[model samples]
Target: MTEFEHMLVNSFNTYIEENGIRAISYRLKQHRFTPQFLDVLVDSLNPDLYLGIECKSISVDKGANALYFSQHFTVDKNGIHQIERISNYLNKSGRRGFLAVELRLGTGHGREAYMIPWNELKKKYFDKDLKLTLQEIRSFPEIKREGKNYRVDPMEWERK
Candidate 1:
């Protein structure tokens, strides 16, 4: 992981602890072959609150207000969607699939994070297999970004 990615993950870990949430994050290296696996797994006493997160990070242009998430597909492969496949798995397993989006500022001063649920994302925003914008994601706030930081709240989960 790059230094920024490392910083995001570490900050997320600290957020998890401060919130008293039971969660664990797996490195991509361990699950590269299994694209259906999530980057982070969050479990709760209330089964309905479980979450599967796919962490994604990108640095936008200066003063950029929005970012996009393109559905994972390889041009070389006929039909392979690593990211969407993971989302499908999490949804089918009775866990909410989420994108842990990290927005890095162009100046490298700070970063913003948001957790967007997959159901809302895929159903309304995703155009076929293209991209979803940050504006659509910001509508729902499982974790809200404040001055480049987001504090995750388990209580904000959308009860399925």
Candidate 2:
């Protein structure tokens, strides 16, 4: 993982702790054969919440809306289809499943950071009963740009 990625994971871990959520963040290593596995796996990472997060950081250009770039990293049709297969395997064994994405700012002017719900993945890959609720979850904080790296404070972003 890159330095910025490390910061984002740390921020997420802090968020889980502050919310009193029982969660663990697993940093996935590059696998030559299994590159599709999530970069991070959050297991039971929230209090009464089971979620999986896939994080991406993008550098924004001047005068551009950061959200525009957020959509690029989402689970595409193929990815969603793959997720369904995984979900099915988990569900057949009676396991809960979820997917989320955290979009953080990288560098340049007008750069901003935020989290976007992978609603497409949830709606298409998961059962209606297994869908995640964004209202019940906490939001991540804006990442700070220092030179070429970005930083986020997990405690500051914790839900009230």
Candidate 3:
């Protein structure tokens, strides 16, 4: 697991425990020769509130405002997708699918994290170039670290 993934998982689990919510977020482990389509699974007391997350990260220079998400398929195999399988399963009715992307701004500059909805990700799959620029990513919901944790949980999650 990447450090960024760890950060999100840690933050979410901490949120669950700290708030005394009846929920649990855990990373799915991969078995031998088996691929784990998603990275995180969040189960809540509310059946409709289940969440699935796929973690991805990229590193860019300090002053750069644009980076690219691996997204050129049929033309190349270097895209950031699981053949749309993850999106297909998690994006169905009543399910929550999310992308936890961390943009590392080199060393000492820290990192910028964003939680993008699956609908947003699916929209990019139809782009002519099939790529997402960092400028576009910044427009999504940005996540920041607070103290030892990052706030990655939804407010309604605490209501339970």
TM-score of model number 3: 0.79
Worst 10 residues of 3 by lDDT: 67-76
- Local error of candidate 3 at residue 30 (angstroms): 1.5
TM-score of each predicted structure versus truth: 0.66, 0.47, 0.79
Report lDDT (Cα) of residue 126, candidate 2: 44
At residue 28, give the lDDT of candidate 2.
74
Q: Where is model 1 more than 4 Å wrong at Cα?
A: 1-32, 62-78, 125-129, 142-150, 157-160
Candidate 2 global CA lDDT score: 0.46
Please list the residue runs of candidate 2 whose C-alpha ends up more than 4 Å from where it truly belongs after superposition: 18-21, 45-48, 62-111, 121-160
Better of 1 and 3 by lDDT: 3
The number of the candidate with the highest lDDT is 3
Q: Please tell me which model should have the higher TM-score, number 1 or number 2.
A: 1
Error of 3 at 104 (Å): 0.4
lDDT of 1 by residue, 1-160 (tens): 5453454455556766776667643345554454437666656555645667777766655544554443332322446455556656876888877766666666656666666777765654445534656665455564555555455564574645
Best by TM-score: 3
Clashing pairs in 3: none
Per-candidate Cα lDDT values, in order, are: 0.58, 0.46, 0.69
